[model samples]
Target: MAKASYLAGVALALAAGSALAADLPSRKAPPPAFVPPPPAFSWTGLYGGVNIGYGFGASSSIRGGELLTQVPGAGPFAGAVDVAAGAWNMPTNLNGVLGGGQIGYNYQFSPWLVVGVEADIQAADLRTSQAAGVSYISPVTGAGVTGYANANQYVDWFGTVRGRLGLTLPSWPNLMIFGTGGFAYGSVESAHRYTRFDGSAPLFATQASATTTSTNTGWTAGGGVEWTPMAFPAWSLKVEYLYTDLGSINQVGTGFYSAGAFGGPATMLVTGNQANFRWHTVRAGVNWHFNPFGSSAPVLAKY
Candidate 1:
């Protein structure tokens, strides 16, 4: 009985020791939890691109003066003439192509938002010309008369300064939609012609010319979409549309020439004219982006 009891005690002790060995702290450590790095900032650099688009615009009608006189060969000279009618309905509501470049600086405000300032200029030959056939009647000469005149004007140059706001999407690569608003400046010019007749007798044939020009400041707004396909290469493209409200301006012009025999020499006439116009443009361009603060590897990660 004593031997059996001693053997049972020894067995219990060995079992407890074996259980402790199994419970000892594990040797293999828990797998390290995945730690993602912080997100990066984009759109910090100088970018320039070419834009090609269409423009639609219009001009206002110009009023003129009338004169009646009786000269040597010309009898009963009766004629109402536009002493001054510079280009009447110049290039307005006309469509044409435009190409230009822009320069800007972008600041990263947040992971998903960016703000920028930009200035650009465009040179185009977009113009429209509308003319009305004019005639004159000499009450003194009791005869009918005829003449010709043309009002051809144009708005060809423009510049803009704007503030741009952009939104960055979470989708792979860099893609955004942006809006812009700011100020714009531009000018308009026109050419004119005049003639006289002594009761359709074509008494004094004279040509007069005039031009009107003015500078205006107005507001502009637009929006566009941008895409960056390759992250490392930092290449981008965008499409946009803009509306400019240039207010209005009066175009005053003048011309000098001979018309009636009574007038020893050519006479000078000044015209008071004005116009109101609105501009619409659609454009697309490419951009190059650089990440100044990025990973040692490719600054941008491509999917």
Candidate 2:
């Protein structure tokens, strides 16, 4: 009877222990692998991206172009007459859209300062066309003269190599504002078409046209604000404004005329067309960073 009581007590203890084990939690599949948060946001990295923007030319900023007239049919003139050259103002609205890609690197040297270098190339259709009557008193004889001028200017493509200096906002860790300036260059084209009429008769005239294209080098300066979203740590967004010089393109036309100043077909008349271009651009862009928040170097490539 004592042995039976011992066996019953042992069975009761084993049942209680099993119930306690059932109440306790299991291992939970190793706590779901302990995922860590993303690293801190940093601008120290290499990035490449694309952008689209509008470009506007300041007609007033363009100077040094020749706006002049051809020789008029002065009765009883003995020699081939020359005309004076003056500055021409492009008509309002030398503006169009532009788009391109950029590559750059940034290094956050201090808590508030970030410096970097960037290169970009763009294709554009920012153009200006004007046809007007230009009048000026002859410098040689003080005679009033009126002539026609026609011009076309274009900023076909442009690029820049610039240095950037940024200021980080303490309140917004992901936002930064920066100033940039450096070498600017582009392809500029201009064409001038002119018809010079002799005397008061509009039906009688000579026509000459010339076109010029050149790659001009100048300077650019601008500022912008950039932001890196927490949700996209490897991508950044920016809105920027820049003012760049469009360089100079000129056309000088010298064609033999059949009749001018009683000089037959071999008579020579010169027509000059000149202009310089400068403009402002506003752009919005996004960049993809490589090796973000890594070592001091922004890019993974070798130096």
Candidate 3:
């Protein structure tokens, strides 16, 4: 019985020690499995690009100005009875080339999405020309004669401010597609002239010239793909295309009179004819982008 009690005590002590050992601090949990964070997207920063595209423009009509008609045949009556007409109609169909540069900044909200603001300007050489004639009748002399003249002008140049939304394609190396829209303002300039005849005689051959500039504000929208074909050490090259529509403008002819030269001032009329114009543009360009937000530099790959 004494020997049995001794064995029991020893067993009890061993069991208690086993319990304490089980409660002791566990092996430092193996360091959490090494896990690298997801790759960071590259979108933040500054960029610049040069664009070239064929530009086609519609004809701009004249509006809001007075067109004057003088009767050479009226003689003294010509000065008093001369009739005046506002721009009956303006000419349209100006075509030209568009070339320019663009600059912008961007912020990325996620690995695949970004937003930005951009501005670009382009110069064009689109123009049109027209001619017309009028006959004047004298109330007193009962005589009439014809006066003739022609005019030419152009509509070219534009600038805009816009917002851009884009998505990065992970499958494609350093490639993104974006859409943009914004407001733009621009103007077109044009000129015209006319001549007068005195009854049976060539009264002083009178000529007139005038130029009107029309400004308008309108909306622009377009989308394109950008590629970083040569990316190395945080730098990449991009090529993109975009389309825009800069709505319409109203044109007015101010007056008519005798002018000696093409650009010289002519006789002034208080009123003129009115017309409207609409325009569209397309462009292709190259850009340089740096990804300061990403751990790795861009890889230049073309699609």
Best by TM-score: 2
Whole-model alpha-carbon lDDT for candidate 2: 0.73
lDDT, candidate 2, at 205: 59
Q: Which RMSD does model 3 reach against the true structure?
A: 10.4
Model with the higher TM-score, candidate 2 or 3: 2
lDDT of each: 0.62, 0.73, 0.59
Predicted candidate 1 versus true structure: per-residue lDDT over 1-303, tens digit per residue: 999999999999999999999999879879997656645546656676667778876344544443432323433232333232332333345456776878787776666887898888877565656655555444434455455556565677777899999988656336778899899987766655545443433465655556667667888999998777654446778898988766655543344434454333334343443445566788888766554333323344445
Ranking, TM-score, top scorer first: 2, 1, 3
Q: If scored against the real structure, what TM-score would every candidate get? A: 0.64, 0.75, 0.59
Query: Which portions of model 3 miss their true places by more than 4 Å?
Result: 1-41, 63-90, 130-149, 155-157, 168-170, 186-188, 196-205, 212-219, 230-270, 273-278, 292-303
Greater TM-score among 1 and 2 belongs to 2
lDDT of candidate 3?
0.59
Write candidate 3's Cα lDDT for 37-128 as tens digits.
64444767888777877655455554433333443443233433334444245466556677778888877776688789989887766566
Across 229-259, the per-residue lDDT of candidate 2 in tens digits comes to 8788888999999999856765676555454
Clash pairs for candidate 2:
45-298, 46-298, 65-274
